[model samples]
Target: MATAVQKITLSSSRDIPFNKLVLSQSNVRRVKAGLSIEELAEDIARRTLLQSLNVRPVLDADGAETGMFEIPAGGRRYRALQLLVKQKRLAKTAPVPCVVRDPATDILAEDDSLAENVQRASLHPLDQFRAFEALREKGKSEEDIAAAFFTSVNVVKQRLRLASVSPALLDVYADDGMSLEQLMAFTVTADQGRQEQLWQAISDSWQKEPYQIRRMLTEKTVRASDRRAVFVGLDAYEAAGGGVLRDLFQSDDGGWLEDVALLDRLVAENLKTEAETIAAEGWKWIEVAIDFPYGHTRGLCELDGMAADLSAEEQGTIEALKAEYARLEADYDGADELPDEVDRRLGEIETALAAFDDRPVIYQPADIARAGVFVGIDAEGTLLVDRGYIRPEDEVPVAEPEQNSDGEPATVAVDGAQPSAAVVQRAVITIGGQVAEPEDEDDDAVKPLPDRLLTELTAERTLALRDKLAITPSVAFQAVLHKFCLDVFSRYSSYGTAMEISVRSASFPVQAQGLKDTPAAKAIDARHKTWEERLPKDRTDLWDWLTALTGDEQAALFAHCASFGVNALYEKGDRYGGGATPHTVEQRIADADRIASAVDLDMVEAGWRPTVESYLGRVPKRRILEAVREGAGKRAAQLIDHLKKGDMAKEAERLLAETGWLPEPLRMAGVDQTATVDATEPEGDREALPEFLAGDDEESPADDADEPHMIAAE
Candidate 1:
């Protein structure tokens, strides 16, 4: 048990001549993997051999040792050295360091090779990041570091960014508290405090998705591709003291501008310069806005202007283009497809021809003096000048001016002239335009209803009729079929009293904002697009196309065409002017209800809710209280009644978010009572009375004698 231990000695290492080393058959590496021999050769040439090769002395058949040695492990390094020698970069007799194994040892060459390759652990990613950082700190440029290692400059930069991440977050990453993707997302923002704050906010929630993190980090910044940023070029933005946030790890759509306000100011300044240049054209009171609303010119009179005539040279150029296009088309008429060069030439010719057609218009001197232009920036960042608008008051009188019998001027003129042709140059701001067209004044024999009232009434009637006709598909089909029969069989029957039935869609004179982007609208558009793609291109082929379809297909088409007839737009009924009687709107809505009940339609299902911006905030304190009372409970309503309108609306919005309660117009067909909150008072507690009805509404402290009352109130 006390026997002396024998000391084991390592294999003797020595510098062997490169030419003397022979490749070992027992090295065991066959297939190629990570680094190629050529790259390895270059690496060894750059920096001499990193690890010593394992080798044994070669023995002759007589058992005497030769001068040559055989390599087992580090075979790749040996091959690299061999390649270097072949390339004349290394001398064949140059000395190479290696550990020489004893031929009498029990260890197998294959075991030694396997152990050398497998026992090494890979460098940790964090360690690599720090290594890159240390290299940078030691004055190695990113490019130099990238070249030193077989990596890209961007890869080097990413590692450096990761290394620069907060020590705390790096620790978290090292401990496996976050993913690589999340860490990359944090690189979008360099502010450590902001990054940590965002992480804390989302770490407890499920909102920690990488995209969500990126969005929150850049929420206050403007994308480089945004119209405003694009208009104010990045160079100009930077020159104006604005900073940009960039993501080197991924495509960020040109990255984000850090100063949104500065970008906006630059955009506005550029727009103003463009407007000022356009204003030099002698327009009458030019109006400038960042964007004109859809119906910005609703009631304004547009002056008819003629497109500028092409000059002789321009006309000749267009003719030449057409001639060349015709020659090319005829030459390739029988070809299955035009050659790319010829196709591109044809496109150039077509564009040249269109350029002449799209020339700017030339307005008459008088119209230009009396009309104005609306200048704005288009979505493409180009100046958009909508010319030729005459405001209602600025419209010139067509009738001859009244003559004064005593030779006195008929009208007062601010310019002190003969009234300046009955037209005026003025700047009148049309605030919140009334879209409906007005009626004639002298048609009292049967005075027409006010435009707004008519629009409101017709809107409800249109929706009701669409609902009724949609559900009664058979009737709709019969009506259309009967009309078609009359058109084909009796061409002379068009003048009869029988209604000329056709789908006349009602335009949206007034619509809720974002009506086009709603889910229902998108669904309808997708369905229309599907049918449009299936339909014939030529109108003449439509009848034949329809006739070839099955009955089900025809009915489906009919329903699709009919659905466009729905119009439920709400408009102000003109309380200040002669309009349809007040009850007419109420009656139309009631009829719509009857039709809606028949079809079992629900506005809630059609995508509508009482949000703070959409409904609750727009209403008053009283309406907010009413909603809370209906949706939540009387006690909830009383609780918020003491708050101001803004606070009350926000609270009510939260209260009604899940109740599914709707305003009168948005209510479902047969729904009467609103859903209630699932809550109750504790046992032995009294119901809370309305603040008005309670005697202790003043919130006064109670006396000893009144303690019982106070306890009851509580």
Candidate 2:
């Protein structure tokens, strides 16, 4: 009789009897040696096994309680339980849930137990390779294996690569604990023969000198042809060998080595011989050319000396050639001169002079002698008389006119009339006066006028008297005198009684004058005074009043005061202080507050309540609570109302459909239930329901195909 089937729960650990758990020998061996076994056990002991174990119960022939179960996967859990038991951490009677299975059924074949094991555990490379082979043998595609094992196709492919590598290398990895990465470098040689050769090379290096294995593998030079041919036929292999040979030795001497010293000496000797020959030929030509009697050095040196005195002979030959070249060049240079027409004109002038009665007199040697005058012609062709005697009577006396009957001297009239002495005197006086005015002025008058007077005048006079103003003036004096005149009479005279009264009323009394005392006056004063106070006292306050006004206020005030000619105030007067218009400042602050409010509201509306809460940390809790209550009462109600009325559910369905969360049928169902139907059909028209009830007619072959007779004819 068969033994009774048992139901049992066991904690995963190495201490669990191996006979009790039905783990594969490969899986059992891997659990015993895996690096993470201890950690997995510790985690299982602490966390009560985060993942449940998948197992199937064994049944006896009699179908009685045997109190035992066979684990389909979760070998790691079994190992962890063994460890826990060894460490005295688990009870032997713990219950584990499992599916019951018939004893005759092949557990690995009936259920994907191995696939589930790989999906859950990090399998060793060797184990994965074996698993991949087993799956492939079972006619499972790589993609199916990948999906079952929760890995990429390429990852499965790489793990399956063990079969492609040399068996010798796989054995080396299994026996010597070689890293999969290091083993991967050898996998590049997929050929059974090449892989075997490479594997032997690696094995020999590892055994004789383990440290040299990495260096040897990295330095291994496989010809491109060989790399390609490893996966192809012998013809490809031979072609690859030919390519390697050609590439390796195409250059002279195979480019493998060069005799550096010999090459260097050869190049140096060729350069030296060429240089010596060039020098010898140069010297021979120089000697032959300089040996002539009529050459440049003929008079300076004899032919023997010419050849021997190299420097002098060389210099003389160069000079002689240069002179001859210059003479030849000068012949062509006349081509650029004036044409013959110009020369003919010059000749005509000479001929005409010769025909004149004067006969174009020339001062010859005899004429100079007869005249008893030594005349010398200078390089410029001007004759110079060194000395000449003059007769006493030959001198012409200076002419003088006798006074007419009117006592006025007889004078030649210019331009039809002799100007009167009085008229001339007046003109001379006017012109002379204008020219001499600045020079003739009193020294005191020439000194610059005070800036006060100059600045207070109209632009016409101000510019006229600009040079008269002081180069530099004290700010206090300029402000009080030039801009704010103290003399009431002068102010009244320039701007009339009304403006003078206004200025006088705004001004401070001489003894009591100060900024505070003239509050209204200072407020209206140019804004430059504030900048001046910030600066050293030496600087001028030119733009004070203008700076105090905002752009709009300035424009408005300019427009308003234009009729009264108040623009001249800024043109002539210096500024006194700085301040912006109240309107503009308040407007800017309000605009900033609006922008900040908008941003704060945006954050709050966007579900950034936490950020808003952080910023309102300084706000009173009661005020915050009040604000939230108000927002909930109004905005929340409105939002809910909007969501209820709007097709938000439909929109959500659409979004879900787009993201593939909702399948096509569910999405279409939602649309059919929510969307309106066509009104053209009667409300009770059951005939329209045929298409919907009959499924899609377009996809049905009976509806799509032609009649049998029509098909046969075609």
Candidate 3:
């Protein structure tokens, strides 16, 4: 055990003159990789050299050592140092640290070179990340680190972001508990608590992914590119102390704005400011919203106004631009490609022409006094001002003064007869744009309103009315039953009017924005979803499955399916029609009353509450006040009576939040026949089911006039 042991000898180390070193043919490195020579040279200039070159002394033909030594390894490092010498920053006589092999050693130069290049391990990625963090902590900017390491600035930033993740997760990553991609996901958010929590939540589940982490962290946020954020610029949002969660590792659609509520408030405030500016333009009313639905002014009248006239100089400039544009276009018309200058000149001409079109419109003082304007943001975030809209109630009345030939004021005839015209032709006294039906020449009889137009208007009302009715399943079922009975009985067909009794769920012709988010709408969506899940998927299996349902399930399902068929629409009554006559409408009402009495459908009890979008917003000021007065009492109505319709609607909504007041159209028209019925009677679960399809996933179509159809079990 005490026997002498031989000591291992490593390759000898020595300093070699830069001028004496020359290219070694035994060197294995040839192709460029990692850092290029130029970048490596820059790095060397910044911080001497990281690795020393491996070299051996050159041997002459007689086995004698030559003055110059041939290099065997670390060729890149040699090139970098040589480049420094060429640039005069380093001297040729400067000695570079190197490892030298004994001239008599049996090891080949190529083996030494290969061993120097391959024997060492690459730096661990985590070590690199920590190194970046250490450099940042040591007062070095990311830019400095990137330049010194010969990498991109973004790469430096990404590494810093990775380093900033929670230490606990970082430990897990270091221990190989997660992949690099997953670690990258956690970097989207800076909150250590959130990062740790999300990892813990999904670590055991199969759903743990970087994208999922990002989604969960930003589910409540608005995208930076969202319209609301676009309207409220990101600079303003951040100034308001709102935060944005950005992903440095992946494209996040410009990242998510973390404070949605702040964004909404900013949007509202900015919109209000925009409204104020437009209001100063002498508009009778100004409507401010993020967006106005197409045909938002359906009931409003449009005023005709003239565009402002162009000045003489402006007109002459436009003419000149037009001439230039024409010349450029004509010259390039047949060319395969337009010349850059010609294209640029044509664009200039177009821009000049467009400036003229932006001139203001001229309106009469009277029209301006009564006309309203809509101020909203367009899809591109540009301010949009739509002017010259007149409400129906603002129409002016034609004035007439009464004076007789005897110089005495004449009174209008009480009998509603018109005076004779100058030619003795029968004078027609019509007002309010009501045109009486013309007499048929063949029969010389007064004809009724055109059946097509009447049906169209009735159809409009029927759909709106039906939307309210379909939500009341009890009422819908009974209404359907009433029609079924009428069709079967075939009783008294005499003295009928032209109205239809069809309950085809009429498509909503118009709806207020965000109406689908109301409590009632949400509840309906949830209910519909419940049924959708409960029912069998295949239509062929529906009947068998329905028959197999329990009594309660059957009753609920029946009510739901029947609601689709319940059409309580009031089409215009024709004296001679195919459907709803005046008499038929009366009968339908009587039948609807019976059903309302039997099931006791109270809209207030069916998860419906009045909100601006659902009710108050669409009505006039008078209607809003009336609802508040009835629901929250007169004091509440008085508090907001002085406000404009829009403001009044908002105030009224808050006041009536707990009040179960419904619009007259949505109220049960049937008499209280169920008040005296036995309380023990079974009303089924129709009352519990919501009015529309249920669940957040069940989106109410944006088009209110989407084809009228039921989400039936079939």
TM-score for each model = 0.61, 0.18, 0.58
lDDT of 3 at 96: 88
Give Cα-based local distance difference scores for all models. 0.68, 0.35, 0.65
Candidate 2 lDDT by residue in tens digits, 380-454: 222322222222332232245468899987743322334332111000001001111121121212222222222
Report how far residue 588 has shifted in candidate 2, in Å. Answer: 77
List where candidate 2 sits over 4 angstroms from the true fold: 1-124, 202-714
Best by TM-score: 1
**Candidates ranked by TM-score, best first?**
1, 3, 2
Displacement of residue 97 (Cα, Å) in model 2 is 3.7
Model 2 lDDT at residue 75? 70
Q: Tell how far residue 3 is off in model 1, in angstroms.
A: 7.4
Candidate 3 lDDT, 635-713, residue by residue in tens: 5555566555655676788788876776543456532222121244355653332322122212221112212211110
The lDDT, on a scale of 0 to 1, for candidate 3 is: 0.65
Give the residue spans of candidate 1 off by over 4 A: 1-8, 19-33, 57-70, 203-206, 326-346, 397-566, 570-714
Best by lDDT: 1
Task: State the lDDT at 211 in candidate 1.
Answer: 77
User: In model 1, which residue pairs have backbone atoms overlapping below 3 Å?
Assistant: 450-579
Could you tell me which 10 consecutive residues in candidate 3 have the lowest summed lDDT?
705-714
